[model samples]
Each structure stands twice: as C-alpha cells, then as structure tokens.
Target: MPQFSRHSRRGRILIAIGLGALLVGTSACTRIRTHQGYQVDKLLVDSVQPGIDNRASVEGTLGRPSFVSQFGEKDWYYVSRDMRALAFSSPKPVDQTILRVRFDPAGNVVAVDRMGLEKVANISPMGATTPTLGRHRSLFDEIFGNIGAVGAAGMGGGSGGGAGGGPNGS
Candidate 1:
C-alpha cells in the first residue's frame, strides 16, 4: 500500500507539471504576435561604386539578398519577415530595409544608401502579390460559366441568369 501511494503521488505530480507547462506555453504564444511581411523592401540604390563593392564583397558584408534583379546583376534585394500570430497567415511588413548600391558601369559600389520602412508608402505595401479587386459576376462571366454549363446539369451545378450591365458604359 505504501509503495502504491508513492507511485500514485508521483503520477499526480507529473500530470500537474505537464498541465502547468501546457498552460504556460499556450498563454505565452499569444503575446504581442507581431508580424513582418515579405517585400522588395523600400531600398533603392541611387548609386554604387562597382570596384569598391562587388558582388562577392557585398555578399560577405551583408547577408544574401531576398531577391536579385531579373534584368541584370546590378540590383540586389534584401528581404525580411516575421510572423503574425501563431497561425498560418501572411504578415504585414512593419519594417523594411532596402540597400540599393548603384554600380557605375563597371559594377562597383558607387554609393550606399539605405531605405527603411518609413520610405515605403502605405499605398504601395511590400510583397509582389497585390490585393486586387475580386472579379464580379458579369455577362462574360455568365457566358463562360454557362458555355459548357448547359451540359453540366445533373452534375450538381447550376447558374442564375440575371441582367447585369457590362463595362465601357454599355
């Protein structure tokens, strides 16, 4: 009986400790929950001295850029991010640091200028995925949806035909 009581007491202690840890973890994760978004950063290199700051030297000084210029190697992008909440959702960029190092024909760091989040405008937030307006159900949409939709009957699908104006003041 003594040994049984000791075992039971230990089990209860372990369960209590586990529950305490779970509560602490769940509560701690909800604090602040800050988030940073992915963007090209507001950094634009007005000038760069190629020989002074080459690709290799730049890489060694600053970390790798998030993206590179598509047209040429003259441009570099340093992207940063954080999470919003613990759930899976895109975060708003609270901050951005874009260091544009323009190279003078030769590809040297001519000038080094940094752009922080302050330079970025609210109108043009970071991120390539712009929040575009959703498509409204229009005449063309109905036609496209109903083009092959006629045969879609019994396929558990259907569409309503309501008069809707078209674009171009028609």
Candidate 2:
C-alpha cells in the first residue's frame, strides 16, 4: 500500500542520516600516529659491531646521527620517537628509542647502547616567576624607590665630589 511505502522511505532516510553522523564522529576522534627522528632497522642495527665497525662503517650503515657529544669523549646519538594524537589534542610519545654509539680517539666504535622510554625525564616549571635571591619590593616601591638615588651620597656623583675631589675635579 502507498501508506506503507511512505513510512518505509522515511525510516530508510533516517537510518542513512544516523549512519553518516556516526561515521563523521568516529573519523574526528581517530588517532593520528606519527614517527619522528631516526627510523631504526633491526637488521642493520644488529650488523654493527664494536671495534670491528669504525665511524665510517657505522655512518654508512645507520646514516648520520641525530647529534654528537659536545664535550668529553666523542659520541653519536640516534633518537627516535613514535607519537599519537586524537582530535585536536597535542601529540604524546607512545614509544621512544635513543641509540648511543661511543667512539674512541681513533674514531673506532667503543660501545653501542640502546635506551627506551624509561630514560625519558619529565620536567614541569614551578610558576610564571623565577625564584631569585633578593629583597621583595611592591609596585609603588619599585617605581619611586630609586627616585632620589641618582645623585645621593657615595653614589659617585653630587656633593661628596668627583675624581680629584670637590665639584670641579681640580
């Protein structure tokens, strides 16, 4: 009957609209995964041997390192991170790897060390103001405190005189 068909059409349209809304909502909340820094290859990493592999061989195998030590013995660092984020939130590290290759004076590999997220440190700043050792002054005190300090007493100016003594320096 015509009445039955009309109701069926309406139900189908409502179902389609509901499905479309659900698809969009889920897409918005989908997590975005990203990789940063060096990409490690297990086989290549395993091939590198201490003493046997020199700086040139290691560089050829792993490419350039992320950073090198600034002081003390020369060391190369390969840092990697896997991050994930949802919606408009900032990305957070899901996994991290820090590979350190130590080198001797002769540029030969001394040791190879690998570290995970356990070594990561989180630091939170105390507040907006930095703690400093000094006397605290109010707004009014800071503004007017030094008003008369310019030429006052042993400030190296006015009354007590200049280089040769007196006001004329004679």
Candidate 3:
C-alpha cells in the first residue's frame, strides 16, 4: 500500500467527521414527535357505571370532563386525542376519542357513550377566501394608502418635528 500524507489524512478525517455530523443534524431535524392530550384512563372510565355513578363519582373517577354541554348542564364530554407530526409540519391526529356522559335531572349518570376516530369529520372551509363585508385592498394600496393622506410635516399641524427636524433632531 502507499503511504498517505499527514495533511491529506487530516483532510479526509475532517470530511468524514463533517459528513457524519451532517447526517446526524439532518436526522435530528426530521425527527417525528407524538403528543397526547387529556390523560383519559380507559379503566377508570369503565369503572364508572351508568345509573350507579353520579356526577361526583364520575368526576372523581375519570376527572372532570373536557367540557360540559353548551345547551344544558346535563351533558359532560371528555376529549382525548393523540397527535403525531414531523419537525416544522402541522400535527396530524393519529387517534381521537370523545367520551360523552349524560346526566339525569337528579345528577345521576344516565348514559355513557364512547366515540372513536371513526366519528371524526374533516371539515374544510367552503372557499379559500373568507367572506368579508368590506373591500379587500392590495399590497400597493396598503403601502401607499396613507402616503398622500399625510402632509410633509408628518401630522399636518406638527411644528416641523418630523424626519430630520424633530425635538431630538440635530
């Protein structure tokens, strides 16, 4: 074999180190993360028996519901969701569950319903442009909209206290 120069060997080592570091950095940047919401324990939820468990017992078991019904106080909802996403990407829902517990007028649990991701609905907006009452102005209109609206002295009645001639000006 042929002997390699010290400088050439050092350069090759540096290049290998740089390539290794680049691979590590890129892999770290593209890492995916899993996020969870509302630690809803299935066992605890199951332990809550309808008609037997009241609002107090249910709350004690599965903790408070994520939110109550907007129309009435008889419905309680627990929302649990798992999201996964890569770096710099919007999180996508991997799993979701909505636990609905209906209470009777006497505050006793009447019904328990568990809804899974199958019930998830992806609602897209009707149009890309949102409906607005006023007219939409362009970038040029915005930048120059107030250009002529102001006077050379800045605020019209200002005593030449703008630009190069202000209270703190030279």
Each prediction's whole-model lDDT (CA):
0.61, 0.91, 0.84
Q: In candidate 2, which residue pairs get closer than 3 Å at backbone N, Cα or C atoms, i.e. clash?
A: none
The global Cα lDDT (0 to 1) of model 1 is: 0.61
Residue runs of model 3 more than 4 Å from their true location after superposition: 1-11, 34-36, 125-128, 131-170
Name the TM-score of candidate 2: 0.81
lDDT of 2 by residue, 54-96 (tens): 9999999999999999996589999999999998998888999
Residue 34 lDDT (model 2): 97
Each prediction's TM-score versus the true structure:
0.41, 0.81, 0.64
Off by over 4 Å in 1: 1-29, 32-51, 82-90, 119-170
* Candidate maximizing lDDT: 2
- Compose the digit string of candidate 3's lDDT tens values, residues 70-125: 98889999988887777788777888889999999999999999998898788778
| 145 Cα displacement, candidate 3 (Å) | 20
Question: How many backbone clashes are present in model 1?
Answer: 14
